[model samples]
Target: MIDIDATLVNVHSEKEGAAPTFKRGYGFHPLTAWIDHGRAGGGQCAAIMLRAGNAGANTAADHQQIIGQALDQVGLGAPRPRSGP
Candidate 1:
């Protein structure tokens, strides 16, 4: 399992002050669980909580992109981005 803080730091370092620019700022944490793989027994699964602001269009889009990149870095691939809540 990967630590959320570490992933965030790696992501932040890649961008130029992009972390703080998040609409309402942001926080993420990943939870790991074991899933049975039938004959193989069990494997790892993750649930990520990515919290961000309800900012304007451009800022929100940018932050979403950043988060997607970060997830990709850790082998998570891109998230299914949602429209506003």
Candidate 2:
């Protein structure tokens, strides 16, 4: 399984993709995906995309791209077929 989320990274200097976040601080918001390993312990990160802090979290296109990249990083090709229960 894959878990994805974005976090705001505080920045002290002007940098590419840095913008004002909801917290009124200038920084970059990076989206990250991590694989779930359960009892085997927390899994490693599969993907990360750095975006301007002003970027919306609910963007569908960005999510799709991130998921595809994450799958690739985990040795799973994008657009894999779903398994039936």
Candidate 3:
């Protein structure tokens, strides 16, 4: 399974794509996907997408793209075929 989330990275210097976040800090918000190994707690990162700090967390387009990249990283293709009856 895969888990996706986003976090704000604090920045001390001016940089492209950096903006004010909800946390009232200047930085970049990056979305990341991780492979859940189950029972193991933490997992390996599958994909990361950098965005401006002001980017919305509930953006459907970004989530879809990130999910697709994560699936690809795990060797899964789009429109995965169903197995078992």
User: For each candidate, C-alpha RMSD in Å?
Assistant: 10.5, 4.9, 5.4
Name the 10 consecutive residues with the lowest summed lDDT in model 2: 76-85
Pairing residues by index, what is the TM-score of model 3? Answer: 0.85
TM-score of each: 0.28, 0.82, 0.85
lDDT per prediction? 0.40, 0.85, 0.88
Weakest lDDT window of 10 consecutive positions for candidate 1:
1-10
Ranking by lDDT: 3, 2, 1
Ranked by lDDT, the better of candidates 2 and 3 is 3
User: Could you give candidate 3's per-residue lDDT for residues 2-83 as a string of tens digits?
Assistant: 8889999999999998999998999999999989857868699999999999998988888888888899997885685543
For this target, which candidate reaches the highest TM-score against the unseen true structure? 3
TM-score-based ranking: 3, 2, 1
Model 1, residue 69: C-alpha shift (Å): 0.5
Q: Report the CA-based lDDT of candidate 2 relative to the real structure.
A: 0.85
lDDT of 2 by residue, 1-85 (tens): 8888999998999998799998899998889888885787778899999999988888777787788889898778747654345
Leading candidate by lDDT:
3
